[model samples]
Target: MQHRPQNWILILDFGSQYTQLIARRVRELNVYCEIHPFNKDLATFADNPPNGVILSGGPSSVNDENAPNINEDIFNWDVPVLGICYGLQILAHNEISGSVEKADRREFGRSELIVDDNTDLLKEIPEESVVWMSHGDHIKELSSNYEVIAHTDNAHVAAVRHDEKPIYGVQFHPEVVHTVYGGQILQNFVYSICHLKGSWTAKSFIESTIEEIREKVGDDRVICGLSGGVDSTVVATLVHEAIGDQLQCIFVDNGVLRKNEFQDVLDIYEDQLHLPVKGIDASDKFLERLKGVVDPEMKRITIGETFIEVFDEAIAHDDSYKYLAQGTLYPDVIESISFKGPSATIKSHHNVGGLPEEMNLDLIEPVRELFKDEVRNVGRELGIPEHFIKRHPFPGPGLAIRIISDVDRPKLDILREADDIFISELRKNDLYDEVWQALAVLLPVQSVGVMGDERTYEFTIGLRAVTSVDGMTADWAHLPHPFLAHVSNRIINEVRGINRVVYDISSKPPSTIEWE
Candidate 1:
């Protein structure tokens, strides 16, 4: 079990794509929230119940034969409850069978919500405002025990409330940004109805995490693998604060990292952060293992196993280390786990899914439940420098995955030079902090290009930059065309082995941030 805030909200997820978004919104209000599978046993939190409960939207329909159902025990807790999208339908189905059914036309986009009663959940929300709707099933008839609080033109039962209890439901998604009053509506529910104090701040998390780490680790030494990314840096600093010299950090060059990344990050860890760290250049070993590995999954697994081997060999001389700490985040865990059942694996993250089953040391992830932005917030509270805290997220497999082909030293060198130019230009143009993540992918496709009045065949580089609140969902950053032209010119002219450059304009649902 991990350390949790005293006043927190419990979000029961029914496999919604936006389940994490709901948690993010709640956390934005300064109230801590956790997402658990809908069928999770409530008895696990019997001693430490949440101040309130939120049912997240999902892709499942309540009328389905094997649909996810509501836990009746939630009512027994007597906590304020708010249901969203599919959550609202399930509640009505539980109250009265067959109350919800398929709609003639699926509502999949923005819709104006008309608030009829602005007493509780809809309190302070605009009388008529845009609300995001993405549901095929709607509450056709609410139970007699419930009253309609709000409605859209298409969805009469857009929002409903129980006659007596502090239970409410909404058909529209309040977690998405498309909903104009979404944040305010959630603020009302969490603050007004639930009476939560919104006490779960970065400082509070750091204080509790420090105490918990010390208690769990005791006098045993801990070894942490630093990736030079924000996540690992924050973890090392937080752990170092708790156990001081008891923690040992190791940063290895995997032969696929950005140019000068190994040494640059090592300097920050040792000099700037004052953490006990050792830098190892195991690029040759990593590159040897990755040679001829073309499949993305295989590449990830190879790098992960190679990383374990390096760490194990580095600490082989000493058996004092009892724990292995990583900077695993919430998205990594969510995307890695087949939480929705079999075939739910989106892609195996190097840190989360690439690890071997058995290891010599126990795993301790300090920020396992936090999102990328949340981790940055924790970094700021921990006194990490502002510039370091805002660094773009670097994948664990490094440029290997970005290569989009088999691993090799020549390919690594090409990618490193190209990526350095892209990143350096972003920083120089004052656009580094504008996007969430940006990288240059060395595509294997080669075409004839005219350079110095000569025809030459060279590799291509794909530029990808995205804007996102968290890494879970993203939209390609709309960088200026002139800026793009300038970066493209520099990459092709300065870096060798590159002919063409293309910009990715796809969003998360259609295309992920990374090509691989």
Candidate 2:
């Protein structure tokens, strides 16, 4: 049963990527919330009604023949409502008589939100506050009950609020990092209008998730897939604390792991934390299936499917392991099953199946409710090593796909050496935390360059350094030329099999930072 916290906010998703961000921002305030499709009957969720309703931004235009719309009953509901982007347009069309027109100046990118002198929705958002906009259609006319409260240079009606009802609408997206004070605006909505209690913190999530896991697992033995990331470390530590010896953590050393990552991770869990863990070196198995696989998607699938096979084999040795536990965080779970399940964020972070379904074991996730940063906090709370918690984001494929071309042991070794040097330099300067992600990709195409008067054809190492809040969007980090020069010099001079290095400067829109 979904626990309904006081004064909940119901988010009706319209298939916008930003919809989950809306719920995330609301949840950040400790206000309970739920997300559902726009067309879901209001009564379907009214058994535990939200204190307020939020309509999410979407791709479809309200004028489209099949555009999604909120339930008509939502209008009659005695609660506050806030509509965003396409949501605002839907509200406009439902309340007013005119349809949305394809905009001559379709709003995109960052803009200043000029607020009306008298409006509560824009109450503390400040005049000329930064906002992110993405929409092609504009509300041409206002209904009798709706009044234009805020506007942008391109959008005449950036925001609207009904004077009589607690309904408000905005054409701009306030749920993204691009929008300054966007969080404050959402805080205002959650606190002032929805009348929610701000008590949902990492500690609260930890307690609730632990209790839920205990109830589900009962006396059955649980197997935790320790992925050696902050997510897995925290989850395994929590379950260990909860069930002690009954919980067994299986840490698979997929051959594609970062250079020496297998042993280093094993040390932390077994030696440092004294965890009930077994380190399985299935690198040979994983690398065998991954040979010559160039497509990134295929690489992920192969690794995922292989992990399931290896884990199943391990569990076979101990029939007592009845539960298959994972360190799946909220973001990963949300995007994986969003279209099919109740999660709003899962539509974004699809962690393709790492395990096969035939290994049918009762599923248990201790940290399913936690986000990335929150998982780190819980790791610290559970006495995990600081170094493990602060480690850079490591994709589960290990290092196979990080090598932009064909997967090979020699190329993998060189790339790891270069990556280690890059990370070491970043750490020496205390710049690791500042960088969102920094990795070295070994480009397949070798260039001819004279080294010590000897004709040499060596692999080029592509250096990617990006700054991002979430991987969904990112900007290239401007490492001081001196730093880049030092890293390039070290990789070419100290590390073998590389003569050239290039810095990736493109942002997330044009580039994903990862070469592959």
Q: Provide the clashing-pair count of each candidate structure.
A: 0, 6
Q: How accurate is candidate 2 locally (lDDT)?
A: 0.78
Q: Which one is best on TM-score?
A: 1
lDDT of 2 at 252: 93
lDDT of 1 by residue, 1-516 (tens): 276777999999888888888999999999988888898899989889998999988888898889999898999989999999989999999988998999998899999999999988888888899999999998888889999999988988999899989999999999999999999999999999999977888899999999999999999999999988999999999999999999999999889889999989898887888999999999999999998999999988998888888889988999888888899998888878875432277788888889899888888899998989889999999999999999999989999899888989888889998899889989999999999999999998999999999998999999999999889899999999999999999889988888888888899976778888
Q: Point to the candidate with the largest lDDT.
A: 1
Runs with alpha carbons beyond 4 Å of true place in candidate 1: 340-343
Question: Where does model 2 exceed 4 Å of error?
Answer: 1-8, 15-17, 32-49, 73-78, 103-119, 125-133, 151-156, 176-181, 333-351
Worst lDDT window (10 residues) for model 1? 338-347
